[model samples]
Target: MQLKKLILLVTVLAGSYTLMAQTDKNSIDDKQNESQKKIKKSKTQLKDAEANFLLNYYEQDGDHSPVTGGRGTEKLENVAPTFVVHIPLDTVSNLDLNFGIDFYTSASTNNIDYFEGRKTGASGKDVRSHINAAYSRDLRNSGNAYSLMAGFSAEFDVTSFNFGGSYTINSKDKNRSLSLDALYMNDSWKLLYPYERRSDGTNWLKDDKRTTMKFGLSYSQVINKRLQALFSAEVVSQTGLLSTPFHRVFFDDVNGIPYDNLRSFSHVEMLDDNRLKIPVSMRLNYYLNDFMRLRTFYRFYTDSWGITAHTASIELPIQITPSLIASPFFRYHTQTSADYFYEFGQVSKAMVDAKETQFYTSDYDLSDLSSTKIGLGLQYSPLLGVGRFKSPFVKNKQVQFKSIGLRTAFYDRSDGLNAWLVSLDFAFTF
Candidate 1:
């Protein structure tokens, strides 16, 4: 069965912000002088509060499932809905809130009780809920900003808590910027083992808690009027129980055990308790014309677990009209297998007895593989919004139906795993 909390960790780390680095340096230098002359000392007030609702659907299938000794159905489906809102707290500060829920089912996880000829108690279906909030403020006219954030997530088998903060500085001209971020997360797991192994009375793991710490740095620069680039790097460290207790690993030399009785020759997945990872990436966006733009990204990743990887991606966005934009993108990624990874039944009891196998796993997610993803995204936005209504919270104000966005993608992995994803977004301003 899949430990869904592991997937949540990846999702949390993927959060990012867009860089608005634009420099039309010779932008009629006269415009800047004239704007400064017309301006007076005043407090920065947000004209409107912003909000968005997002929904996502995902489906995938594969042949290798560690829960079944690395050979079983890996079909899964998930739907997630999220909401985000930002409210102006004062003239220079704002509060942001985000919350979401994920509902999912997995055939692989259902097989967790296969050996017992039962499926009702397995993680066949589940739901996760999460919430996060942040408070941010800008140093008046000092080109500095800072934010503090806190979040929590929970599911049937795991619960997590996280806290973080960020600081950013921008050049006076607003064409260059740097940001630093730090986060710490702690998780407590409700230990569950393979159905058969649970009755064996063996303490498979010494700990059921995990902790992660991450630090990131990023810089963005605007080049001339047509190009902008961002560079980022992050270091992540994790410790404690890192392996799934329900994942099974089979050995080849199990005294000719029947194939149907795989659990008799299987052991729980094992791995090191500590890990460190580093990833560096760069993104470049080029303005080709008023209607088209090109965006490119590249990343290099490595970890203490003897895995290295590279990823590259490109996207082209075309403006069909003043209110419509279409973007198509493609990405490719390749990575080496972890040192302790092995296929089904590739290990032996003799190796373990002789201390030749201190750590091992049959998880294909850690195996050598390549993947490709392609997608198209569309956004519809109008200058005056599609609809408007009176604001309920503010006097003499209106709420606007700002925009709608949709994106769909297909992913293919060399290991016979394939997935599809679709997402929708609704944006509003009040």
Candidate 2:
């Protein structure tokens, strides 16, 4: 009896010790997991509020001004300034604000009073202003995110309002992502007709409002450690006043022609009331070395107006130093003419009067053309930023001058149009 009791006691003690050991192991594992999660959260949280300022100067010159019936100078200059800000609402949410203004002068628009031989004044210059706001949030630990946006823009001739939303899903490993977005825009025009055609006492347009809808889907993937790619597709639909009220179209027939010293016959541009467009694009990036990267892009576009376009571009970004980068890029684009697009004096007035066609336009933008753009961009950003200053709005805080960027480009079109653009950008963190 004594031997049996001793054996039972030993067995019970061993079993109890084993159970205690397992419980301690589980507790340690739970604490370790909780600590790791905290570390990750801390690393992912936003640390500062960011802001950017941008300034741009653009100028263009070309022939074939639609305002002058596609046979005059098309010279324009513009200065634009934009500001952007991003604020962290929480660990997983952010708010973004963007505002911009554009000041422009156009010789083509000045021609509105050319027929009357009046001096171009306010008709040649205009200002446009725009503002946009967005809010975005991420679903914690779910790899899902969403954003909502609203914007408005106004100018002397038109006002536009837009609203949009986007949803994104990322893979658990963060190597792949898919995004979907949709937007709607409404534009209202003042119907500013040309100087010579204003008193014709005719209702030239059916509606002064235009509506546009866009939907897009994009997918990005990390093919390998050295390569990444993105594919995107979009569908766009537009309705209402699709033609410019002030653009003039000339015809070949008698009523559209001229006698000795007579002015060429012209009418307002016309187009379909509704249109549809589809575009697909792809971007590929390859890490060539520690100091250089290659980025390539291609796009195919088609529309219901009998137009098709293709675009291809390549860029090489070189790391000049730890804090500096330089990128040189080239782009080429080609497009077929729209079905209703006619050059200067290509369409006959009698054919239109006889109802041979329902739509016609002399706008060079709708004509078959090819274009090339080449540019270089430089950026400089230091490890701790270029400098720091005390925050004006927040006490006991500092703002850092994060980076500066400069970009310049030259663009040329197959049809006698050429343009130059230069822009500067500055970034700050508070």
> Which predicted model would earn the best TM-score?
1
TM-score of 2: 0.88
Pairs with steric clashes in candidate 2: none
Give lDDT per model, in order.
Answer: 0.77, 0.73
Please give the distance, in angstroms, between residue 326's alpha carbon in candidate 2 and its true position after superposition. Answer: 0.8
Q: Measured by C-alpha RMSD in angstroms, how accurate is candidate 1?
A: 7.0
At residue 263, give the lDDT of candidate 2: 39
TM-score, per-candidate, Cα-based: 0.90, 0.88
Top candidate on lDDT is: 1
Model 2, residue 204: what's the lDDT? 83
Query: Model 1, 70-166: lDDT tens per residue?
Result: 7888888888888888888987888888788889888877887778877443348889898888888888779789888888889888888888888
lDDT of 2 by residue, 111-200 (tens): 765667653433377787877788888888797998888777777777877777889999999999999887777888888777667777
